[model samples]
Target: MTHFGIICPPVTGHLNPMIALGYELKQRGHSVSLLGWEQHREMVEATGIHFVPILSPRQAPQPDQKITSSRRMRLRHKLHRLKQRLQPVDHQAYTQSNGISALRIALAAYQHWSAIALRAAPAVIKAKGIDVLLVSETSYGGSTVAEYMGIPFITICVGIPRHQSSAVPPYMTSWPYQLALWARIRNRLTYAWLDILQRRILRLLNRYRRDWNLVPYTTLTDSASPLASLACLPKAFDFPVSLPHNFYFTGPYINDICRKPVTFPFDQLSDKPLIYASTGTLSNQASVYRCIAAACDGLDIQLVISLGGKGRDVALSNLPGNPLVVDYAPQIELLKRASLVITHAGLNTILESLAQGVPMVAIPGVLDQPGAAARLERSGAGKFIALKQLNAKRLRKLIQEVLQDPTYKDQARQAQAVIQQSGGVKHAAAIIEDVLDLAHISV
Candidate 1:
């Protein structure tokens, strides 16, 4: 049996997939150890995997009262949204919302992540332990640790495919360039900037590494093996990569492994089409909820609204003349039966919906959402409605048009077909095992 040490962010979005993969690996006789916040340790251990504690400060408290989806202090929102573009903004603000602490928490996470990897190195070397370190493309810890161990390491990208030069994940944007020259130029500039940032970050980490008990720098992502990593994303979306054949697409990993808490009372809906609504975890706008509620009011349809964790904030009244109001709905479950979806265009939500064959209305919030929303529009799977422009009238109108049209559904189905045929989790797992086999043979 091999022991694999993992370092992942403490957030639910990041940790879920990693946990799914680790659980699967454990079922196959391999042991996985995770280093993350103590808050999440119990959940990790519940999967029958070993968990190591990390010390990161707690994020500041949020507004004490429950807020309506679209309700916020107007003045505060204007200022906050303005800074969204200039992220890494005061980093302090990030704490209350995402449970981010001071810069030290981020630093602590890095240190904790690195230390776990470093400590695992002796186990790896002494036991001929891990065959290779498997890392989420977003997590720098395992890769850094791999460098120190001088062992083969692979990255498990959770998002869409991308080239080596990016400060964020590639799946955050839709890269369908009608103009090759423009696309190349964009990539080049993006690469240049990313390279500068990566180098800068590496410099900081390298200094902290020794003090934090980590090894020295390793090569950055390679064209050869740079990130010829494993991915839980499907093969259809994998596109043709510039990397080697060894790079893999593992079907959607660990996130789906858990039994979903969401459900829909299908019996309640009318015979008309279904529209699934969600603004994702970060931006669960009530505007979309109110608008969708209005749009479907008199129609013979079903509207399943997932307000992320803010359902109560949406204030469901007697009811939409045609829809059912639920605080949380199983997105994939509902989308499978949906004629249309209203979303915040988050990468995870959009990808999952696309995979389920549902067209969408993408209302992007901060971060990479706007970019993801634009791509959805480009893919013909959805249209973008900036949060600033979102309202009941506009949202209701958009829902009506999308529901009335067949073209959007067709496009969604086409994408879905690709996703369905892409040989999801099993396909992804096979690729990872293949990498392990190759690594075993090579070293």
Candidate 2:
């Protein structure tokens, strides 16, 4: 049996899918362990997979103490500033400023996390005698650690696939997929700009590579595993762009059997058509929630808002609609009954909505969300509005449009058909095993 080491960001969106995949592999008789932050130990171990703490006690955030590190404090300040700047005022200016600020903040966080992982992960993997590694595409240090140890690893795209191509727009933008020459040129130029902006991250990675006596990665894609690169996105939901031969779209690694149980007030659900609204687990902005509540206030449908564990302190009673507000909702279960989903266009939520054949109106925030929303729109499954363009009146109009239109549901059902056949966690496990077998044969 292969002993697998799983590495991903500590955030819920990334961790959930990787853990689900790990759980599936363990069920198939392979041992699996997650190397992550100390705070995530309980959440990771709950899935019956072993958890390895990668950060020293000095570096890990303490539950009761405030983090006073200069880097962390600066990050918190940047986030606070970002939240303030996300107000729906000037659409064009907001988009530009937000993109730059968000990119800076993301790069800073990546550099910090990668530094810790590169320092600590090698020893843990060696100590555990891991046979194979499953690294998230977003976790910059996982593949580096595997290479330094001379082990095989597989790349898991927990979000949108980050494989670069001039034919496809960058993951951060809401640009549509167009095969025209001009469109390709625009995509290439954007990628070039991004490469320049990300020089610092590349330099940081190469510094470690040099010290480890490994070849430096000139591009981010060089870090992806040649054996296999797997994505949780369904093939049907993505743009018609060609990817590397090693890449496989294995649908979403959704293993509800291993997920943390959330206590939702199911009895409070009414007979009215359900509208599930969420900004995902990471984005718990009260302003966004307020706008959503205001838009659905007078509608006939019953609105259910999930604060994603970050909104417990939000005054639910003060929200415009008397919507059922929960810190966490049983999302997969709720989507089954939902007629419409208003979301931040997170891939997991979008895939879950499509799996249940529920249409959506997307208000994409940051990271790969805009790209996912673009694909959702291209697939004829949903409509999307830029977060900066979101307001009560506009969002309500789009919500009504999606709900009244039959085509959206029809398209969603078509996508649902593809998801049902994509083999999800099972397919992912089988692929990993196949890759492992092939690697062994080559050796």
Candidate 3:
């Protein structure tokens, strides 16, 4: 039997797609193992895959931030990361977030996590007899591991920028045309800096890689210069501008919805249009959730809101007569029934919402969320609101606009129809198998 090994960041945005891939493999009789933090054990276990826990030297990472959502600030974000790398701080205590400060924090964690893997991963690889290594696009040291093991590696593209860092070529892709020429030049310089940074990081990783007594990989194979990458998202939502072969656009790999399904309160609004408000797994902004809830109050349409992370305690109690207030709700189920989705613009959530043909009210909080929201607006599927201006009154107006404009739903439905027919998770699994087959052939 073939074995697949996965390493991913702890966040659900990273972990969930990996889990879906693992489950897909398990159903086909392949043994799967996951490497992650303890908090994600249950998520991996739920997929029926063997889970292996890994630890960093310390918790509470300082911050590794990058700007991914907006092309306007992405170069600036990279410059910020470069400055952090040049300046040495505690480094061990930062979470990998999307801002400059956050990126500074993650750089240390990325190195620390890889350093630990240097000793531990080889043992696991030998023990599992892994055939292929599917590393996260944003995962710290996974690309290096695949090289160290001499195994086939495939990176999953959950979003743009960081997720595309290891796989997509920097030179080939450029910022949107609307960006000023100076900004584009700056973005190019930032990309060059990142390219240098990635090379240095890989050099450090390769030292341990050689120590593992494994055959080393060439720079190109290990993402030395990225161009065109693969993803499971649908082409209708995201089309490849440059590298068509690089992306395996398998559509959104929604986690299997068969777990006895949680029943949300959407059944109450059979007549009025239904809207779902969610902030996704990370950056669960209470302010956004409360604002959405408050705006939704007294509306005739049914409202289901998800306030994830830490807790789902949405304090917007005593709603205006009609809106249903729930701390947590079945998002997938809600999206299927929803006419509109109020969201933080996460790729997974945004794609799922679009796949279901539900228009969006994108409230960009941090990171690629704003980009996802912008995509929605550009595609005519939704509107984007910066977190600073998000409020009930604004949301109420947006929802009304979405309802009045048939084109929004029509646009969303177009994307949904395309994604639904684009082969979703099953197709993604098939692509992975092909990559594995190619790996075996090469070996």
Top of the candidates by lDDT: 2
Return the lDDT, model 3, position 180. Answer: 53
Better-scoring candidate (lDDT), 1 or 2: 2
Query: What does candidate 3's lDDT look like per residue over 277-384, in tens digits?
Result: 777632335566566767777767777666653343334555454466555577777787888888777888888888788888877644456546655676789887
Ten consecutive residues with minimal summed lDDT in candidate 3? 58-67
Models ranked on lDDT:
2, 3, 1
Tens-digit lDDT track of model 2 for 134-229: 988977878888887888999999899986788889998999989899999999998898888777667667766765668999988788998999
TM-score of each: 0.71, 0.89, 0.76
lDDT computed for candidate 3:
0.62
Off by over 4 Å in 2: 56-97, 281-284, 312-316, 441-443
Q: List the residue pairs that clash in candidate 2.
A: 232-251
- Which candidate do you rate higher for TM-score, 1 or 2? 2
Better of 2 and 3 by lDDT: 2
Provide the global lDDT of candidate 1 against the true structure.
0.58
Instruction: Please give the lDDT score at residue 104 for candidate 1.
Output: 27
Reference-based TM-score, model 1: 0.71
**What is residue 96's positional error in candidate 3, in angstroms?**
14
